[model samples]
Target: MSGRIPHVIRRVGAVVGRLSVYVLIWAGLALLMATAVIRFYWGEITVGQMLLNLVSVETDGGGGPIVWIGVLAIGVLPLLLTVGIAALWQHVRRRERRRRGHDVRPRRSQWVKRTVATALVGAVVVGGTTAFATTVGIGDYIAAGNSKYDLGDYYVEPSVTGAEHRRNLVLIYLESGEATLADDQLFEKDAFAPLKEVTEAADGWQSVADLQQTQGGGWTMAGLTSTQCGVPLKGVGSAAGNGALHELGGEDSYLGGVTCLGDVLDEHGYRSVFLGGANASFAAKDVFLGSHGYSEVKDLSDWRAAGEPEQSFRDDWGLSDGRLMAHAKDEVDELHAEAERTGQPFNLTVLTLDTHEPVHVYDYCTVDTQNVVTSVFFCSMTQVAGFVDHMQEKGYLDDTAVVIVGDHLKHMSAGDAFHEQLDHHDNRTVFNRIWVPGEDGNSTLRPRVDQLNMYPTILEAAGMTLQDRAAGLGVSAFAPDVPAGSAQAMAPEAYADLLGSRSARFYAEAWAGGDAAR
Candidate 1:
């Protein structure tokens, strides 16, 4: 009985050791596979961007059934593959042992040793591959410095004296919108035809084919900050002891010392309100907007409080584009009336949400397309065009400068299927259209512009001039005085240096420090 007990104990230990090995193998393989998938989808995933987003409340909450399904598929496939390979390897090893007349029973000591060796090898492989991939993808940006550019002192301040008039500003940030939306070559059907027609026919509208993203310009919050402040949003080196500006709170001042378009408008006595179909709290948008001088930041909670039907909150994101557009029209009337009464120019910024991830199409989406995402894309564009038409019909276009731009390039998750249709989806461009009250088609054409250029371009479109027609490493692409091959033409390496510089870090930290002090 004692001899049988020893054998049973050894068998149980061996089984346990093998099981532990299986878990380690699965984890290691999953890490490698996950990195590959993320790289494929996002091109380059940065540590700072990941940390910033992970800390945000919105990161965990959003996305619907389709998103979860895709996530599960991505997550489960590697695990199953690892298990299958392990099983096959085990079977082959057993067969060999039996053919050689060796002991078929697993030895506890051998199993432990084999498992440790396999786990160690896997760890090394995973670590090496991850390091290499990150280096290739985002290392340049992370190691960037601004020594060559001397952009540390570069700052943009709006000069009301240089302006012909303070035109009312209607800035529409289309969520994950891109030029590819209108590309008939990219999609089986064009999703942005209505928008294209509107921009083509409208005078004073400048449409740019190439609007490239900078280091921090790929994500939504970073895109918004870059376009608005002419600077990239960066995280602090450490958030260990900061009370007010801790990891979660520090995002508010990511562009702290940098002056934004909203600040300029506010200083010039312009009333600014930001309306969005999603939670303004998601990226601390409300805080960012408020700190930058927006008076009212209306978001999901506001819509619900104002008696928006509970059914309308169907999307993972708050209101649908159609519903938001409808609500925006009413808000436009109120703002316009208030502007008329107070004689203050108003800045109405609307951020659409229907085109957000999982590509939820509202019940009102009538566009016919083979892909549900395409249908949603078309429907969102249609809604935007309709709003523009509404503004024109209501006489808001006469004095208002409508600046329509994608907050960022279309998120890769939103275009997984769409990418399969396009010949080359790399370096995808975001859409940009600047409509002044009375001007004809594309007076000036540039080959390409960076996201930072949009900051000064918006002011230029509003008939406002900067002190030097440049702001925060950005020269207005529309400004005649802007020298050719300015920052807009900077090489990717130079731009990365600028993003990774101490000056950029200082600016970010200053913002965080100020927030912490407060």
Candidate 2:
């Protein structure tokens, strides 16, 4: 029995050794595919946000799954093929050795050759991937984007004024809401026309003429962080040393040390709530909101619990925008009534999920345009328009400051719908409309102001004045003039450099706390 045990152990070790080559291949291919797919969908994403999404985020049940499917195909298919070929070769070698009446064992030279080949494959994969990452600016995505200045020096503790005369805020984030798509000459149809007509400047809505999406601000989390926190979303410094992430995806309160718009409102005795069609758990939206100040969160599960029809609860990303808008209207009415009864102000933040690519076409949307995405964008607008019309009718606009803006620019990935017109388009800007009561409807905003500026702009629109019209890294577009060297006033190149920095001390304090042991 002891002799048999040794033989069994030897056999098992041999099998593991043989399988290691295929395992290595599979791992390398999987990593390559994952990086490629992530970059394709979200260009210039931070390593922190990328890792967080990998470990914590939920998929848009529709197009989001397709990306993973493609990655799996690359990872698994090549491994299967390699294993099958290796097995066949081993069988042929065994047959030949038997025919010659000799040992079937592979020669030392053959083993050496196999080891060399496997090592070469690993090198090529790792080397090629590194080259690709470098080409795409590894520093930009990694934690070394800027090394010039400490972000802590520039960060201002967020403050709010005029709490006594607070106005309800309706902040809507439109998916892929790029103003570039509005040009009829560039594209076949103006996708933003419906939204434009609904929130026309002539109708008391002020639109930002040049609402730029900041550099390294491609994904939803980045946009949300910038707009709410007035700071760009960068990852914590190396956590595991093995390149594994441990911060953003974990239970550690998201940027617990940082103060945000929600926190300010909460401190001033405002009831804050967030509503979205997708899962609140995605990208730690709940964690961020809860940590900051939101008291109520309405997401996919909430809508489902309320008995939305299965069809209306879109498999791609929970409820459709049409359905989400309907619920938002109801939520506004309920909140407005409660506010009037209690005399406490409220904030309703809504995020739309349609127009997210592999754009899911629901029953309510019509496909009149040649590009399906265009039609989808137009349909999403109709839903937003409906909510705007509702606010106007209920006279909610009288006391509510409505801000409609896109989360980020449209993705022009390889498989996305509108690359023909969207790709390499020099003119790309996020569309934004701000409607503040008792303000000039035709107010001209600071040109070239990016999404970061929206943080303070929203505060001011709600009648909360910032001492310097600045918070975090942004200046208010509503401010008469931005500080000369502030983020909003800096040149585009310099501003990108400023936000792209590692900011280890600053982020460490922001993520953990100023006094918490690192």
Best by TM-score: 2
Q: lDDT of candidate 2?
A: 0.78
lDDT of 2 by residue, 255-331 (tens): 77777888888888889999988888877888888888899988988888899898886665678999999999999
lDDT of 2 at 332: 97
lDDT of 1 at 172: 93
TM-score (all chains, Cα) for each model: 0.78, 0.87
RMSD of each: 6.0, 4.3
Q: Which 10-residue span in candidate 2 carries the lowest summed lDDT?
A: 238-247
Q: In each prediction, how many residue pairs overlap at the backbone (N, C-alpha, C within less than 3 A)?
A: 4, 3
What residue pairs clash in candidate 2, if any at all?
61-316, 62-316, 146-501
